[model samples]
Target chain A: MTASPTPTDAPPLPWTCPFCALLCDGVALARGETLELRGSDCPKARQALAQQPADTAAATPTIDGRAASLDEALDAAARLLAGATLPLFAGLATDVAGIRSLYALASARDAILDHLLGDAIMASVRPLQDRGVYYTTLAEVRTRADLIVCFGTRPAERYPEFFRRIAPGEPRRREIVFVGTDTDPAAAGPDTELEAVPFAGDAFDTLALLNALAADRALAAPPPGPLAGLAARLQAARYAVIVWEPGASGAQGALVGEAINRLVGTLNARTRAASLALGGSQGGYTANQVVTWLSGLPLRTGLFRDGLRHDPWALATARVLAGRNADLLLWVSSFDPSATPPAADLPTIILGHAAMPPVAGAPQVFIPVATPGIGAAGHLFRLDGGVVVPLVQARDDGLPTVAAIAGAIAQRLAAPASGAGS
Target chain B: MSAPAAVFELRLRALPRFRVDLAGVTPLALGALGEAEAGRVAIRHGNEALALGELFEIRRRPANAPALHFEGDLSRFDRLAWEMEDGEIRVDGPVGHYAAARLRGGLVAVAGDAGGFAACEMAGGELAVAGSVGDFAAAALPGSMDGMRGGTLVVRGDAGARFADRMRRGTAFVFGNAGDFFASRLVAGTIALGGRCGAHPGWAMRRGTLVFAGETPAVPATFVETGHDLRVIWTLLARDLARAGGPFTALPDRRVRRFAGDIAVDGKGEWLLPE
Candidate 1:
């Protein structure tokens, strides 16, 4: 609804947004007759835009799913969701401003809001959440931390600049330790220690190592090579950091969680320990941010119930499909649709943005929206914890902002309930 | 009353074997803990720390039988109480593995399920779990020959595989259906199942009993039924479990079937089933 590119003859500057983990920052788009999407010099964005359907299809969505008057599409999306019992409005991290709108909608519906990495984010923060530890920003890692531990995760696979960010700046001689999975030590840059521990199916192995270390025992154990010595080193460290991937530990519950957090807290009792969540999905932090801000708990909370209940083995779509918890899946992801849905058998309603394919039973509602960095200008918080970066703009028009769409939907939804203020 | 010194607070983070300022503190004062801050934080002794938030999250104060109340996702925090002396702890969410690892005394009640090593190496204490626990619960630490010794461990819901491996002493019971590998080496203790029991239960038992009250999967490998009874112990256990919130606590009038286990051994251990 903003002024059209003024019918300029030359191409207009594209707006880039880094809200999503993608950080695809420059793109050119507009709506003359049909919605158009253009990517900057970014290869991935160009490929995605080119893959968009030449024109809008009858059933499936194209580059312009919300081509209809933004008001009309938002109204339909809102009215449809407002009446459902299991309404789940999620995947709002793409645009920070839109998060406010999402909060409004979720409150109004009393619905379950989730993201791709529900369990992972919660698990990453579980230890600190339970034992009452301090919260540190990524800036701490870049400066204060002398040693960094990445257990069962590789940041390069997603956040390409992870090493540069965490190991960048002052002293530059910081040491990095990667544990759990096997990795070629040479690949990680200078002086980084990569310890390979045979992958066990469960996290109790870590506990075993801790026990060996804390007890100063070493009888040629596999996972815990030199427990006693390790414990001593850990206890004597000035500021040691331990980090693990989300799935490194299984799901969370009441008791086991307390036990795990206690373990972490005990380890950190003598030193400083913090975690770096890779991302919500492949490495996105939006899901983590959204879930924390809303439920006062992490993702995978059974907010669908009156109070936010936590049943990891149950609530997850996969677990539910595994015949662990209730049915009727409501999946929300900010990625391509044709991509795999965690639980294939359960009936689902997949809400996402991207030129992706459709999954069976899970009715795919394609939401044509702007790419964080490539299509719009906005602030993008990275997964290093809190790395808020301003996205450079590149797109011209027709690219509806994710925040704008979320806002319209919230407005339409609140119309029936609280009216104006809502 | 003489003016009491101002209360000091400490926020508890979700970490196993987590030790804080409450070493000599009373439960009445401990119950003031909560989960509010972001990133696994808790309030503690005014001095700001990590994990959860500031100490004394709970605002209310209660007398006698004071309890330490925890509010947050405790799945990562293990060892609910390590050699606890006294008092009680109530967690709002599921706890991580080894909840109550080596619990010495007092009541540790969880609003949700627990993790592995539940009451592991427990010398003396009482733990009540509303949900199921992970493997090796109430069992000894890996490589340790003995399991629970002194204390009572009760699980209201089902348990994972290997319910109780190497039991030494004490009593461990489940109200609902039990998991696989019910009981391994019965050194000297009692494991009573109110519902179905898992396979290979009571294997290599020197003494002690593994009881099944409901439908079982494959009762096998050196275990035979003994006799039925409505003894005073059953009445006492039923009353206690019921009062602790059991589905059949109010109806303890029914007869309890007794199944003697590992006849190869002394066979003094007996499993109590609902007749």
Candidate 2:
């Protein structure tokens, strides 16, 4: 692979930060001894870039904690998969191409596929499945939302550039309300008015009141003062968007999502309103989309010889690991080095970031792969689940992409073994 | 009705290391196969394909009806009797998720606890579990429009959350306690609970009848008390449930206080609290 122009001798390149789900493409990055951010000073982008030094040593593949050739590692992985009674393919933190290839391998090996953030992703998905949703994209929120309600989360904490990304180009009056949470200082602008409402009871209780009030239901007792005002404002707004982060919603986040959907549905009856979910970071959406389109089922589905079966709760990564339901685990994490596989006694194979530290255990094969947007060009679905953002490679690290490694393993699994191989 | 004599009995040889998919191994399907052919029938064990004989010891017996009996700790087995159109299936031990899902017509009985999504989206059948069940029992499949369109589901023990979610049509009886969001977003159905239940029962329900036969649950703020004139409706439902025999046998003698309105959606659903 040819190397791109280094930052020491060239100007900062227009870059898309793959650190978060926002995938902020408005920034420029200069790669020198340490990565420098220009145009936008998002701390998350800086922190992520700081982890990837300009002149870091490349990682090599290993078998059973000892150094091995890539071909040798692939062969060992294929052997493990072939013998596995149930192989779980998880930690899917790679781009679109990586998930596509992994799905093919999952089908070939009859593996059960799930993302590391499956729980958070399911928080949004469960509601969409139970009752349909009225959702809006980031662009829609940026251009047309007159009233914005951040429910149970401060988006800027995880997504540093969320407020900046949605800052309206033309100055117009916008009311920003925070429910069951404090208002984000980042949301303060010249034309923005902010307010916060305390929860009526718990989240469920509060949402129940809100849904009832929005639908004009005559409650025996009057609703909470702030919630009633918020409902009235929601009805009055020209275009309203309710922003929620599923990861922040706790164990019963799906219920929170459903409540948000109910509120949105009720408001849409009278006026314009929609919800914006902030999650699916680290290629969660990419894997879900790819798996769904390929097999007509979402993640946490098993491609059995009998047929496909999808059980979100039973097939959760934590549940599966606790039950020892799977005998082998194939974990792929190419974006973040800190994202490691959970401790399990099963035979494990990891296709991960080049800078990832050695994981402790035997009967494991570790193959370091290229990080998309940093070392190789790729595409990722944005948090809004609408647009696919093109990721530009900042450098050529010469590490094979996850797609290549997974594809190679699939090839090895399909091919007839040579005499005395393994 | 007394238990139909089992035409085929499948006893587990050993505990499987991985979950087995017993979806197509229904009574009618297995009854047609000879002893040798039945043993060779393919089933999924984890990711690998295995013959039925590898996992179970199959014994055939002459019977009048198409029936199959499973004897083992089948907690690692999933999709049991899935999509079975007609026949009788019985399990002596616990079964995993999606058991008897989409069952069009049949009788599925489990003596032990059932895993999540048990009898999910069942169109028509009679499913009875002697023990408890996990979440989403008789609920819709993920992204599906309706749940338990038609059937009779009776859980003698407790039930988990989201029970009968989006159920359009069915008559379900949970004789023990239930978790939160019971009968949530219910389109239309008749569900009876014989014990205490968790919060938010009958939430966002458009149409349905929820009968709390044991303990009256605290009604949500969205629902309001209505006149107690539903005796005609209650008598019709009670007659059928009483015949099923269990906690529901005493339901006919009880008077009920009625409440209506999830008003958040369509507020026509009713919750009958036994007084």
Per-candidate DockQ versus the true complex?
0.03, 0.52
Cand. 2 TM to true fold: 0.93
Reference-based lDDT, each prediction: 0.52, 0.87
Model 2: which residue pairs collide?
none
Model 1: docking quality category: incorrect
- Candidate 2 on B1-275: residue-level lDDT in tens? 13443488889899988777888998878877777889999988776678999888999887888888899998888889899988899999999888888999989999999998888899999899999999999998878889889988999999999899888998999999999889988999899888889877887788999988887887777787888678898888888777766677888898878898787677899988877
Question: Lowest summed-lDDT stretch of 10 residues in model 2 chain A?
Answer: A413-422
lDDT string for model 2 (A1-422, tens) is 23555657578888988888899898887766666888998998888787774554557889989999889999898888888867899999999999989888888777788999999999988898877789999889999999999998889999999999999999988999999988889999979999999888767777878888888888877777899999999989999999999988887788789989989988888899999999988998888888889999888998865578887887898888988889899999988889999998999999988878899975999998888888888999899997899998888777888899888988887777721112
Point out where model 2 deviates above 4 Å.
Answer: A1-10, A53-55, A418-422, B1-6, B228-232, B235-255
Report the Cα lDDT for residue B72, model 1.
63
Which lDDT tens digits does candidate 1 get at residues A1-422? Answer: 24533343545445442423435334455434333445534343444445444432332332223334444555545545543444443333454544555555555555555555555655555444533433445667667766665555665544444555555464445455555555634326554555544423334434334533443333232333433344455566555555445543443321223333343455576666554445543223655565567667655554543356443323444433443232233344333433445644433433344454554444323455554443455565565566555664433334566666666666665564624222
Q: For candidate 1 chain B, which ten residues in a row score worst on lDDT? A: B1-10
B-chain TM-score, candidate 2: 0.95
Model 1 chain A TM-score equals: 0.69
| Per-prediction TM-score | 0.53, 0.93
Candidate 1's error at A416, in angstroms?
Answer: 6.1
Candidate 2 chain B: 10-residue stretch with minimal lDDT: B1-10
